[model samples]
Target: MASAVKVLLIDDASLIRRLLGRVLNQDPLIEVVGEAENGQEGVELARTLQPQVIILDIEMPVMNGMEALPLLKKAAPKARIIMFSTLTESGARATLDALSAGADDYVTKPSNTGSFAATAGQINKQLAPMIKALAASATTYPSIRPHAEPKAAQQTVPDADHSWLTVTSDGAPEIVVVGVSTGGPQALQTFVPALPADLEVPVLIVQHMPAMFTRLLAERLDAQSAVKVGEATNGQVVKPGEVWFAPGGEHMYVTRQGENIVLTTDTAPPVNECRPAVDPLFESAVENFGSRVLGVMLTGMGNDGLAGSRLIKSVDGYVIVQDQASSVVWGMPGMVAKADLADQILPLNEIAPRVVDLLSTPRNRK
Candidate 1:
C-alpha cells in the first residue's frame, strides 16, 4: 500500500488544531504529523517534520500566516501550504493575498452553524480532498510556480512549430472566455497581464471561489493588469478592452440586448458542484458570440468546462487549454485534452500570445 500523506496543522485556536488533527487522522490515507498554535511554531515544526502538507491559519499571534508564509517556504521548500481562512470579507482578502504570496490553496473556516459535527463535516469535505490533491503534486510540481517576465520580454513569436493556430474554422473571436480554478489566481497573474491593453475583444472569466474572493480577485487583477478588470454585475454592458469575472455564488452568463452584449448573473443551481462554474460561463459566451468565441481553459481541478468546450468546438470555435507541465492540477485541462476537444494545448505562458494571434487574424465572417 502507498504511504499516507503527511499533514501538519497550524492555527491559533486549540480547538481548530484539535478538530483538524482528529478529522484528518480518521482518514487512513492521511496522517497528522504535527500541530502548532502559531506561525512561528508552525515554521519550526515544518522544518523538522518536513510534512507533505501544511494547513495554516491566517489570523494568529506572534506570527500570522502571511508573516510566516515566506519563512515556511524557506524552511520547507517542498511542502504545499493550504491556508485556513474565515468566510468573511477580510478572510477572503487575506486568502487571495496568501494565494498570490505562494500558498497552494485555501479552505474557509466553517461558518457558525452551532454544531460541532457540521463544522467537522465542512472541514473534511473541503480540506481532505484538497490535501490529497496538493500532496500528490508536491514532489512533481513546485509549490509556487516561477515568476514570469513582463509582457514585453515574454512575447511568443510564431514559427513553423506553431502550426496548430490554423484549426479555427470559425471567424476571428469576438469575445474571449476563460475557465479556471485551483491554481487560477497565480495562473491569471501570468496570463492576463500579457494581454494587450488595447485588446479589441472583451474577456470574461470564471474562477471558482466564494462571494468576496471573486470581487477581491477582480480588484487585484485590475490593479496589476493593463486591461480593465472588474467583477461582473447583473446588467453590466460588456465592452472591448475590459475583463470581467463572474461573481461568486452566482452563475454569470451573457445576453444580447439589441446592439450590446450584457453580462448577467443568477443564483441558479450550481453546475459541476461549483457556483461560478466554468461550464456556464463558456456556454453563455458561445450563445452570445456564436462561432466568434475563444475558449481558454487554464489550470484547475475537475472537468467543469468539458461540456462547454464541446459546444465551442461543435461550432468550430477555437479552444485551447494550459498544458499539464504548467498546470498545478491537470484535471480540468486534462479532461478536455483526453477527449480530443481542444484545438491546441499550450503552456500557460504561451496561451496569451496565441490568444492575441487568433484575435488579430481575419476570419471569413458571413
Candidate 2:
C-alpha cells in the first residue's frame, strides 16, 4: 500500500487545531501525524515528525510563522509548508512574508466556526491537487535557488522631453489593469506601494488566489498604498487614485456606462484554469476601454495572461510584460514575450516607472 501523506498542524487555538485535525483526518490520503499550538513547538514537532506537509498558522505567541519558517525549512528542507492565516490586512502581510520566507502554500482560517465541519472538504478540494502536483514535481524539479534582487534598467523614453509633464486628452489613459500569479504577493508589495499617489487613472488587479486570500490581499494593499485598494464589488464605479482587485472564485470585468466605468463580478466559467483569470479582464478592457487601457502582465507560473495580452494588443491597448530574468517562474510574462504580444518587456524594478512614463506621455495617445 502507498504511504499516506503525513501532516503537522500548528496553530495557537486549541479549537482550530481540533477542527482542522478532524477535517484533515477525513482524507484517506492524508494523516495528521502531529500538532503544535505555537511556532516554537511547531518547529520542534516538525523536526521530530519529518512530515510531508506542515500547516502553519501565521500568528502564534511563542514564535510567529514568518520567523519559524526559515528555521523549519533548515530543520526539514523537504517538508512542504502550508500557511494558515486570518482574513485580515495584518494576516495578509504576514502570509506574504511567510511565502517569501519559503512557505509553499497558504489557506485562510474560516470566520464561521460553525462551518468547521466542512473545512476539510473545502481545503482538500482547493489544496490537495496543488499539494499532489508539488510533490510530483519536486522529484523531477530542483528546489528553487534564492533569487538576487533585480537591478533597475535605465532606458530613455522616446518622448523624453514630454514624458514627465505631458498629459493630453488623447493620451490620458483612464484605467491601469494588472495581472499576476504565483510570486505575485512579493511583486505586488514592491510594485503597488511604489505607484505615484497622484496617479490619474484607476487600477484594476487580478491576482490568482483563493477567495479569502484575495480579500486579505486587498486590505493589505489598501493599508500600504496611498491609493485606496479593495476587493472589486459588483456595480462599483471605477475611480482614479483607487484600485479594485478581482475577487477570488469569480471573474471581474469592466463595463462603461456613460462617462464612468464600473466593476462587475460573476461566476463565469474558468478561463486558463482560474476563475479570476487575467484573460477575461484583458478581454473586457479591449471591449470596454479600447485604446484607453494599459495592460500589464507580471511574474507568475503559467500562461494565464498571454492570451489576454494578445487581446489587449488587438484593440491597440498598450501591453507591458515583466522580463524573464526578473520573474520568479517566468511562465505568464514569458508567454507574452514569446508570442510578441508585449510592446516592451522590462524587469520588475523598471515596470512601474515605465508604466508611469508611458501613461505620462502625450504621443501614445488613445
Candidate 3:
C-alpha cells in the first residue's frame, strides 16, 4: 500500500484541534502525526515530526502564525504550510501577510461551532486535490534564473524604444478582461489599487479562489481600489470605473445590451478544472467585444488562460501576460508566453504602469 501523507495540525483551541483531527483522519491518504495548541509548540512539533504538510492557524497564542511561519520554514523547509484563517477583514489581511511571509496557501475556518461537517467537506474538496498535485510536482527538477531588465532610457518614459505599450489597432478597446490565480492576491493588491479612478472602460476579472474567499477578496480590493470592486452578481451591468470579480464556483461572461455590457453568471461545468476559469471569461470578452478587447493574464498556476489568449489574438485583440520572474507559480502566464500568445510579457511591478500607459496613449482613442 502507498504511504499516507503525514500532516501536522496547529491551532490554539482544543475544539479546533479535535475537529481538524477528526476531519483529516477521515481521509485514508492523510495521517495526523502531531498536534499543537500554540504557534511556538507548533514550530517545535513541525521540526520534530517532519510531516509532509502543516495546517496552521494564524491566531495561535505565543507566536501567532505570521511570527512562527519563518521559524517553521527554517526547521522544515520542504513541508507546505497552509494557514487557517477566519472570514473577516483582519483575517484576510493576516492571511495575505502570511502568504507574503511564505505560506503556500490558506483556508477559512468555520464561522459557527456546529458547521464542522460543512467546513470539513469544503476543506477536503478544495485542499486534498491541491495537495496531491503539489506532491506530484514537488519531485520535478527545474532551476529558475533572475530576469534581465531593459536598459534605462534618457526620457521620462523608460525603455520607450522597447516599450510593450504600442497600439496595433485603430480604436478604443471595448472591453478589459483580467486573469489571475495562485499569488494573485498579492499581485492584485499591488496592481488594482494603482488604476485611475476615472477609468473609462468596463473591467472584468477572473481570479482563482474559493467561494467565501472571493467575497473577502472583493471586499479587500474594494477597500483599496479607486474602482468599485465587488463580487459579480447575475445580470449586473458592467460600467466604467467599476470592476467585477467572477464569483467562485461560477463562470462569469459578458453580453452586450445596446452600447453597454451586462455581466452574466452561470453554473456551467468547470473549465480547465476551474469554475471561474479564465478561459471562459477571456473567450466571452472576445465574442462580446471582438477586436476592441484587452486581455491581461497575470500570475497563476496551470495553463488556464492560454487558449483564451489565442482567441483574443485571432480577433486582433491585445494581450499582456505577467513575466515569469515576478510570478509565484509561473504556470498561467508562462503558458501564454510559451505559446507566443502574449503581445508583451512584463514583470509584476511594471504591469500596472504598462496598463496605464496603454490606456492613456493617444492611439488608444483611435
What C-alpha lDDT do the candidate models reach, one value each? 0.83, 0.75, 0.77
RMSD of every candidate to native, in Å, equals: 7.5, 8.8, 8.3
Roughly what TM-score does model 1 have, to 2 decimal places?
0.89
- Model 2 residue runs over 4 Å out of place are 1-64, 73-81, 85-104, 108-172, 362-366
lDDT for model 2, on a 0 to 1 scale?
0.75
Q: What does the lDDT come to for candidate 1? A: 0.83
Ranking of models by TM-score: 1, 3, 2
Residue 246's lDDT within candidate 2 is 96
Which of the numbered candidates is closest to the native, going by highest TM-score?
A: 1
By how many angstroms RMSD does model 3 differ from the true structure? 8.3
Name the best candidate (by lDDT).
1
Q: What are the per-residue Cα lDDT tens digits for candidate 3 across 192-221?
A: 888789887877889987676677788888
- Which stretch of 10 consecutive residues in model 3 shows the poorest summed lDDT? 150-159
Indicate whether candidate 1 or candidate 2 has the larger TM-score: 1
Tens-place lDDT per residue, model 1, 247-363, is 989999987899898999999999998898988888777666766888999988778998888777755677888987888778788787776677777889999988888788735
After the best TM-score superposition of candidate 1, give how far the Cα of residue 49 lies from its true spot, in angstroms.
Answer: 1.2
- Candidate 3 ranges beyond 4 A from true positions: 1-37, 45-54, 59-63, 70-80, 85-97, 100-102, 108-125, 128-169, 362-366
Candidate 1 residues lying further than 4 Å off, grouped into runs, are: 138-168, 362-366
Candidate 2 lDDT trough over 10 residues, lowest sum = 149-158
